[model samples]
Target: MVKQEKVKVKPLPATIIPPTSWVKYFKEWHGLKFPVITCRPLGRLGNLMGEYATMYSLKRHYNVSVVMNSEFKSRIKHIFLNTSLPDIPASAGPFQLQDWTPVQNIGSLYNYAPIELAAAGLLGPKKFIMKEYAFEMQMFHQFREELKKEFTFAPNYTNKVNEFLSNIMKNRSSQLPDPVFVGFHIRRTDYKKFVKNKFGGHLPGTSYFTRALTHYRTKYPDAAVFVVASDDLQYARAELQQYQDVYFSQGFSAGQDMALLSSCNHSIITLGSFGFWTAYLAGGEVVYADVTTKHDYRFSRKSFEKFGLDYFIPLSVD
Candidate 1:
């Protein structure tokens, strides 16, 4: 037998940007001298949406580059596969930090001033860095079509998503004619703390899920298969097992899980931007938890409105 050669997996480069290269690149791209807008994204996958939205909005007017926090680089690559967004290379020379602008509050209140304001600031000769969550969904609304092109899943994850859907469909074919895949995202783990702190009233209970499931069953009685995606798979499996034709996604990365969730025909989402993004990408019927009572800092009604999903059913836990 011939000896098998092992393929080596290359580690991600320490820095994507070369020192002082950003300043030079910016001038060339615009065909004139211009300030560099470097955006530093913070937090996990959900919060990154806000940062990306801000970047997307800024890109329309100014030269923008993302300086991703070291921890989230892998996650970013997984979620935004084969996409090209101008990112500040790790080796790029130091960026001139600017005053932190509080855009989340302004964007939350349905104001467009922040976008224009940031653009106006870039008109000056000085390079600047934006330090904010910039979680405004509206910032991305105008360019959503363009954004969708940039936020596609990588091929490996895409294949897994397709496989999951195929398996669910095949399993359900015997029980019902034309089974409808309904994705449910039960965000627990850290969200439990949010509940304990009275951040969002109370965590959505089993009753809320059951009620939402029943509504779908009634509407699509032909057949419905619930594909559950959650941080706590064991708890999710136990809690949702009462319903027939229920299934749980096997161990998968968060990016893979979101791809599966987005592939469904319908979505049952709880709190968090991750769920919101899955439902948004699914572009199907959605039933979300009504956590309006909990004044969670990240939860924003305006964000949902910006998605143009007026028909989403909000199931109240209280």
Candidate 2:
């Protein structure tokens, strides 16, 4: 008798808690199962670059399902802050397919491949191409160039950031200012081991934000609010007091800040991924710290300038 071929049931991409744009592809690739895994609290960059991205790619291409035991989630939450990158072990390879409990199919949502590319890292030179994917790849190259621009963090976060924009638009009730607006970012969590593992490391803090806000007030008396987002709430709040019109958003679980930041009109970014994502979301001009080699904070005018982003004013640390 001939050996039988194994049945290939399409597996769905895993559902990450605090869901991100990556999910866009899962719904688009209709043949795959729906959310084979549930990764709650993928807030840390370590989780993003390592487990989160890794698992996502695996599911996207290979149809694997990973389940972090509930017990582990409970244990890790208590020790999360003090935990280092090495503390979290990589998942066992080629997740076991037998673990999946079968489920019925649900209806499909509309599919848009351009939306998927943003989260999939497909826009990078070495990755997927819109020319090849065609309908799915619309805006792939243009958007990639747009992403390299200062305001192009990922270009996808803005798709749903209306809440933040509405708040700013509502706040802009008075007569409009001459030049548009400015945003400020104070990234306090840059150095922690979690951040360095993914985005290389943190950048130094220059006092550029305070100076710009002061100047905007002097030059454009009617300038609107300077929206400021920070990793360390207490640290940013104290330093920002000099600007009476500044608005601060409550801190969000790690990767979620990009969604919130993208809604704003403009921004000032520090030298970190969090700030970069926010600036990308805003898609407007920005001001950055003049990083010194000795300090090694990584925002460069060259980086943002490629995307039509520029620093309106430089800040002074002293």
List candidate 1 stretches off by more than 4 Å. Answer: 1-33, 61-74, 89-116, 195-200, 294-303
C-alpha TM-score for every candidate: 0.76, 0.45
Alpha-carbon shift of residue 218 in model 2 (angstroms): 5.3
Poorest 10 consecutive residues by lDDT, candidate 1: 1-10
lDDT of each: 0.63, 0.43
lDDT of 1 by residue, 171-289 (tens): 66464688888889888888778566755455687877787788788878868778889888988988988766688888577888888888888998888777877776776788877
Residue pairs with clashing backbones, model 2: 11-33, 12-33, 149-307, 151-280, 153-280, 183-267, 183-268, 203-297, 204-297, 208-315
Give the per-residue lDDT of model 2 (tens digit) for 1-318.
111222333322232222333333344212323333323333444222223223234334434333343432453433223221121123433323344332211232113233243334333212121111111111221333333331222333443345565666676655675335556777775455534654444454434555556555665576656777777878788877666577777555443455566555666766655565556546665555544332222244333333233322234333
Residue 168 of model 1: what lDDT? 69
**Least accurate 10 contiguous residues by lDDT in model 2:** 129-138
